[model samples]
Target: MNNYNLNHLKELESEAIYVLREVASQFQNPAILFSGGKDSIILTHLALKAFYPAKIPFPLVHIDTGHNFPETIKFRDDIVDRLGARLIVGSVQNTINDGKVREESGRDASRNALQTVTLLDAIEENKIDCAIGGARRDEEKSRAKERFFSHRDEFGQWNPKHQRAELWNLFNGRMNSGEHFRAFPISNWTEMDVWQYILSEGIDVPSLYIAHNREVVWRNNTWLPYSDLIKLRPEEEIVEKLVRFRTLGDITITGAIESGADSLTKVVVEVASSRQTERGNRSDDKRSETSMEDRKRLGYF
Candidate 1:
């Protein structure tokens, strides 16, 4: 009668909870960046767990790309309302209107790049000293170099080489005026780790994560959802497929994976034995070899 071995997941949970609490205690105005994606959902769940019996002290910030999936937006609103957490939307469209950013023009252009400006503008406008996110080092090579408490300059830009030495779990969140930090709670967790944790905790995510029938087109080595944001080229044709999204954002660029992992158990199994990286289906990252690094350097969620 001695076969309980969920300690690994428990440890990860504890570490994330500790980071969330640290963010709350150290930053004056901190907000969790909620993207309605798998990672961000886990962050929200951890925040709730960290401050149970008391409401989450920080608000949830969503940088709206205007090209989001309808389901993702609905799920975001529902989660915020259910949690009674304040929601702030940094609209890329509004940033465009303010002349703070410009909309890219092309069949392949997406608001993914424009989101950086909107996110940084939001930080400046809201005076958010620290922004918490759910990025993991194992997700991509660029993020692998990120620190638990990453610093940003006054312009919201990050010099990868200038990153402070983070050794022995000693995080230095202190920053000068007009500068801020981006804290990642589950920065050490991997894709399989996330799925396993979600499975163990029964955390609910958007339906798109589960297999479903949707109109999609094959392009750029992945299935692209049919949406108003996309103007299908002549070479592409829509067909119904039982597919699910591995990542989400700027519907125009997000890609879907062909799968039948509808249940959490099935999804965990799929993730456990999958060959592709979770971010493999993301067209945004596939834009160039240094796409993610370039974006993270500029400012991102």
Candidate 2:
């Protein structure tokens, strides 16, 4: 039984590695979107395994929202240094300063939605034909519509209706000039599968995922961390709590959950018994039922 479970992970790993290799072979200018999130971390690890003994041919791209957790940034830099890989950062702050995107207003304002413009800008600026992302189909409804090679139109908009069919394990990276593809190497991976694989491989993840004491405020039915970017409501009060983030994004919108799972093994156990999805804490998705799908159409990742 243990061997069977191990082989399941090996199969997923093989599929991800094959997809990464396909991206390298098919695209002239391909880059992996590295957000320092667990999914992206796993993607980077698979890319390394896919091209062992040779330096990864593609660069790592980050769409910096200027609102990320400091630990995420630190982890990103450390990983890049360890890998000896090139990193390209697209700043959402720069996009705002350049009048390309406007920041939202009020206490609920977040830079989460503004990352799309920066991502598109980076892809165009870098001439990236294929942008490999760590998005998984099980994470959200919009992501479920994605193929192994998700196509983006000339304007970087995703039209689910126009997506090409992937028969068998075959993928078509062909696209017209001015258009590009958003490839998801681990599209079929589930949250449990990711955690199990991480444990099996002994991969390191950001510490924010582990339970710790932090000052947070109750907002939007989740524990919103106290950050300078967040505007405190008149009724809201800051209080320290044992919390951990399931998904990391702009700190303003990424909420934490009360947890006692301080270690990876405990985290895996917690995930198994939890009823809510990992993304349940993310406030951005709470805006609407189709919020993620809407964003994808507008070129948001």
Alpha carbon lDDT of each predicted model: 0.90, 0.93
- TM-scores for candidates 1 onward, in order: 0.96, 0.97
lDDT by residue for model 1 over 1-301, one digit each (tens)?
A: 9986658889899889989998998899999999999999999999999999899999999999888899999999999999999999999999999997888887678788899999998999999999999999998998999999999999999889888998876788998999999999999899888989888888889999899999999988889999876788999999999998877877788889999998888988888888999889888898899999999999876
Q: In candidate 1, which residue ranges exceed 4 Å CA deviation?
A: 1-6
Name every residue pair that clashes in candidate 1. Answer: none
| Model 2 local distance difference test score | 0.93
lDDT of 1: 0.90
